[model samples]
Target: MDAGGVDLDARRNTNAGTRLISMASGTFNASIQRVKAWSFADAAKTSPTYDWYPMYGMAVSYSGSNVTSASGKSISSPIAASFVQNYRTQNFKRVLFEYIPDVKVMIDSLSDNHDALNSHVIHGVSNPGAWITFTGDSAIPPGTIKGQAEGDTKKYHIRADEKTGEFTFVLPEGNYLTAGNKIWIYAFLNGKETLTSTIVEDKTPPDKPILNAITDKDASFVGSAEANSSVTIYRVSDHSVLGTTKADAKGNFTLVLAASQKPLVPYLEYVAVAKDMAGNESVQSDAKTVQDTTPPSADAITQFIQVGSSFDLKAKMLVTNVRDNAGNDDDNLSYTLLKKPDIEVVGKSEAVVEIADKAGNKVSVSVPVFVKDQNSSVSKEAMLQAEDFMVKARELPKDETEWDAFILKQAKARAWGVPAGNDISDNIIVTNRGVFSEKAGTYTITLRVKDVEKTIQAVVIPGTLSIKKIPSDIQFGMQKIRSFEQRIKPQEETKVTVEDGRSEKTRWQLTAMLEAPFKINEEEKLPDSLVLASKNMDGNIRYTPINTQGTTPVFQKETASEGLTEIDLNPAGNTGLMLDLMPGNIRSGKVYQTKIVWTLENTP
Candidate 1:
């Protein structure tokens, strides 16, 4: 090779003693014989100051055993060839040499246990374009410099970047490291092994926490779980965290729900989750209900009461009209009467009713009782003197000072008014408002005490006597003319009413007489009528005729104590006008009329 950018090829053939020579650039194939030194003439410079040439060289040489020098001076089996450029006394060689070196692969980074459970990546530096492999649970042996050894060790392979010596091996999905288990990562690239080991923390989650009952009235949520575990209370309604706390050494945890930034919802379901120190979260606990804390309400009662009267105010009766929440039952309610009502008085009284539920909630109300005195009455007298009157009654409440706490009103008539200033003298009430004189009639008085009322009557006997409701004119029906005397009765019955208001010691008599005789015409006349009256004796009717002289007694009273008397002149075959009929004595077509006079006399 020479600086003129040319290569030299020398070869010797022994069969025909042939030898060939050629000039080449770059590499040369040569079999030299008896040659020790070689050189290339430097090319002349086109300009001494502006000369230039490209560097050229060969990295290979040819040596054959058939080569022999003609002088029999044998050349070495291999000879040196060189290319040099000499210009202006400077020598330059154009050739580079390279050799294979041992591979140096190292693992620089690996995922920790926590990260290995998620994103697992192995990082290392290696020769460019070199093959890389990762293994778990087993490390590549030291000083391993050749192809991979045949073994049961786990492995993963990857190719590094052609331009960069950096390599990475990522674990496939669903591959993870167990908690608290030590795992080794082995990276092999180009038969060079590098490994690193890490102890994986806990990865298996603890069991779900056991949650306690949560009531709306409670301030915290309490439960038990793994020791040193973090508990989070979540509102199932929204999956939001209500509060959080850490479990003690005894696996007991309490989360203060009242301390939460946002209020927790009532009557909603909630659950708890426990997170271990290794960041492992457990499944949610059983759902718990947040109970409500509202209490019940009751209504008031009013009852009308009287002395000796009993009222049943039991607990069930008190809660009959109560309003309560669904969480409370009517049977769970009880009542306590603070005080018994006073029913003996004729006034209002209060009964304090206090009702409570099983949850220790209470409601209070006041029940009013309208109390009235027991009813009382006084005996009424059919007749009384003009002096002061006394009343006899029953069921009257005792009075210390006065027993006249009663009202008086006229029952039948208001012929007189009671004085406003009337007073009771010797237990007798002064009932007259005018000049003192008792009227001769039955008078009724109403007695009142608070809300009770009673009635009594007082009759002031009069010194005078009178008769009322005199009997009307009597009439006899048509009689048949007969030879024998026949008795005929009147067509209608007559009635008479009498009253005797005289003193108790006085006697009275009543009499009746015929005022006019029966006459039909100037020339014809009816028989004299016999006026008869009937009286009841032992349930039997007895008829007796009265004298026409107006002196015979028809009805009479022995004394004023008899009060009022009445008599009926029933003509049914017994009483009323009786007539004697004879043949041709009465006319058939004639109408007879008669009149009767009644008199009353206060005698003996």
Candidate 2:
């Protein structure tokens, strides 16, 4: 135990003996050393021994040291340890790494790389483009993450900018990552251990929700969409959001429409949209209409009519409408008369008219009709005395231009008994509906009179057919033309006017022909753009009546003496001979005029 002096026995055991040993090995000042130290006890040996050194050093070839690989795959091999230098040569740190394993991850960078996923917009509606950004401690060179799922592979790694580490990532339009997906980040930098992050994404909109049905009663709507997603109901008529609700896990949703919304009109359409947890909203679904709630229209009925000479008269009842909205199903409606009308009597009869539709909605009304037997005939003596009708002979006044058909009741009533209108009067039925003048002249026709009961009749003196009251002439007023645009209807009178012809029976036709195009000047002649057409009451245009010579029948059969009634020059049609000027023929500063001819003739 003496210093520096050992006997063979002590030397072997203490110096080079197998009892103690020391060894060392390393690279980059990184190494591992093992040693055994021994000391001789003074005499009695206690648990006391020289301070002992347990195994230590840069952690022997740190390998197989791993955590979950960013990819989530169970990966394990070896962790490469490297020495990173700092400002001071002697100051350094060990970075557990594997060649800074390349990963094709888009590092959307701002300041530093971090998973602030909670701050990201769910499915960005306003800013729909999708990608990610972050800041990293060091520049991440471009590289790829090998051996990844088909679509999970990132082929290009994000490279950090020099200082800002600011960069943008733009995904292909249709390739945006969807909601509920996650991005696995595995990054490495000098002097730092591997960095990682898991960002669940919500960048895609949910599928459209279905608008299955809408009811008018409860103002309710129902449909299905993405499970667990929220649904928003909208009134498509105005695109106003009607209500919102959460879909059950099964994707079914019901919406009791908001009471604050305006009352639903008939056939109001409703649509639904879905939103996922990621704030992604789906497009609107198909539309459906609300129920029909309006009731049918009807009015009370009351009437008094003379009974027939033999039996009771059946007067028609009054009804406005009998079915659902717009009465679309009116034809499907059924009616039930609660009570029958009187068959033979002069008394009030009440009948309830019940109207029912396919939707089971019903309405009813009561009609009370009174019947009386007061319709009497002329006395026998009055009918028997009837003879040749006596009428005042009439002569043309002066310069007669038209004639009208007429029947004279000039007979001084032989007995004149029945009701005032039933007394013998002008029997010439033709009144104002017929035109009788082919040419203006003094004309006369015999009059015929008949008793109300038609049991007696007579003939009277001839009567004159002469023009009477006449209407104003046609005048197309002034007009202003701006851009040569739409066609213009001439401001002419609503109807044409001419002299009326008085006659009992006459048949004639009026034809007209328009002159050629209006000549404004030698170099500016307006094309014959005027179209003379007639319209039915419904406003539908009729074919051009002009013949090859521009002559078209303007008046017809109503003027025939066979059924001539009264004097109406233009009675054939009220909305007749309408004229329109086409746009192409319009000039910015020129006016136009043309001559027209009218000819009357007997029906061919």
Candidate 3:
């Protein structure tokens, strides 16, 4: 073992034989092994420098005869069930603990009734500074709260660790330090300090709650506080508590409000109060007035409205004061129209109108209305008047035929009704047949007219008819055609006047003939070339001579209806005839006269 970094194996093997060469009686002689004289005079036997230790304790071990395990201890027999370990020497029992110096302390085993946290026994703890008592209850009683008051067991400090979530305290000495005390033992490593936390026992009641409002809804009174509570409502006057109602999750409650026992009433008021879970009562809510007393009025419908199918549904009615008694206090007033007798018919249907006020009180009235269809009816009697019954004609034949009912000018005679439904008044047809009485008496006829739906009768009353004529005398006035130039000019001839016939169907015509052709007063005669001729009202001429003396047709009804319709003196050449003279035929100066008979007859 020199300091040369070389192996010193010489002293390891055959160690006894190499100490010298002999084994004497038991050991070597001390005289031979000793150095008799030693000197420490100049040099001191002190270690020269510091160096690392050889770390000689062998941590690696194996199981063998005496050393049977890695813990380097003799293997003992299997733990005897009845053997007392160290009992003969010591009375205190042993407890194994896993302890890390200044780091952690865990109780792994216990000898007595010591309760540890997390089911771990606080084994081998010494000189405890704080102790913990864990009970089933979170509330620590007044006398039980240690170290909180003077004259109390101040050394027995108890606290619940808010950070570590543990109960720790200083265990009192003597009987208080006994096992099974449900206590925690904290080693005296650090001094005690104050700790604060929640307390389970709450003695003070909750704060005064607020009372918001109370209202009435139909048979119940309702209120709200927006809190979780139970409420009770009371009649204010009698101070009688009404039925209680639990608030909903949202704290809205409804209390049953009884109806008034008697009909006669001023409204009643009720008050309410709420109570929370802590038995704290809130102030009384506002007094709420509640009533639904008034029955709907105007139920006796005296007069009914008249309605037709043609009427607009929006039309207002004034038949009765149809509304509820509480209408002013209610939210709204509305009316519904229903068919009375529950029958839906077009004509004369009863309208059961129910009117409701906001309080849900309703009254129905039966209204009688004339519910006719939109179609209107017209009778033929309204179409005929007095004018339609009579005709003032001249003395006609007693055997006169019936005037055609179709020929009657309805536009001029018949009186018409208003246009209704499919009845076009302008297109109404009134058929009748009658002749005017000869002496102005009753003129009877049945007139039927069909409208949109049905046929009806109309009375054609007697109406008057008349006629007159003038200027019956037609004269071909005297004219002098002695000179040849005078004969060339034309003159206005004779014209006969006629009026419309009394019977509108009467037609007339004219025919003419001459005894001699242009005779001069029946003495001197003109030549055949100067014959008698007449021009029609239309400016047409015809001549006739004695040699050709056949009657010539003059004015005919078929040719022109002028004379038959009205006056023949129309401005459009319907009045006068023209006399035209030929120049080659001459006549001496003479006055002339002629006759024209216009026969008025019922021809057309």
Best by lDDT: 1
Q: Write the residue-wise lDDT of candidate 1 on 451-526 in tens digits.
A: 2234455544444456677655666666666777676766676677776544444767777676655667656755
Clashes of 3: 14
Q: lDDT for every model? A: 0.51, 0.42, 0.37
Cα distance off (Å), candidate 2, residue 428:
51
Estimate the TM-score of every prediction: 0.37, 0.32, 0.28
TM-score of 1: 0.37
RMSD of each: 18.5, 34.2, 24.7
| Per-residue alpha-carbon lDDT of candidate 2 for residues 101-219, written as tens digits (9 for 90 to 100) | 12223433121112233323111111111122322212333344332222234343433343443334433232223333444444322211124444445555677788876555656
lDDT of 1 at 397: 22
Query: Per-residue lDDT for 1-604 in model 3, tens only?
Result: 1121321122233333232111222211111010111112211323211111111111222222111111111111221111112111011111111121131223332222123232222223222333333332222212254542223343433443434534433233221222223333332222222222221221222223333333233556666753677788777889987778777887777765556622312246767777766555667777766655454555433221223224334212523654443343324566666544222332333456666666566666665443222222224323222223234333333553534333233223333332221223344344543443444444444433443222222233322222344455444456655434322212333334544433333344544454455545656544343333456588675554322255444455643332223434212342224344555454556544444333444345
TM-score winner: 1
Clash tally for model 1:
6
Q: Provide the clashing-pair count of each candidate structure.
A: 6, 30, 14
What TM-score does prediction 2 earn?
0.32
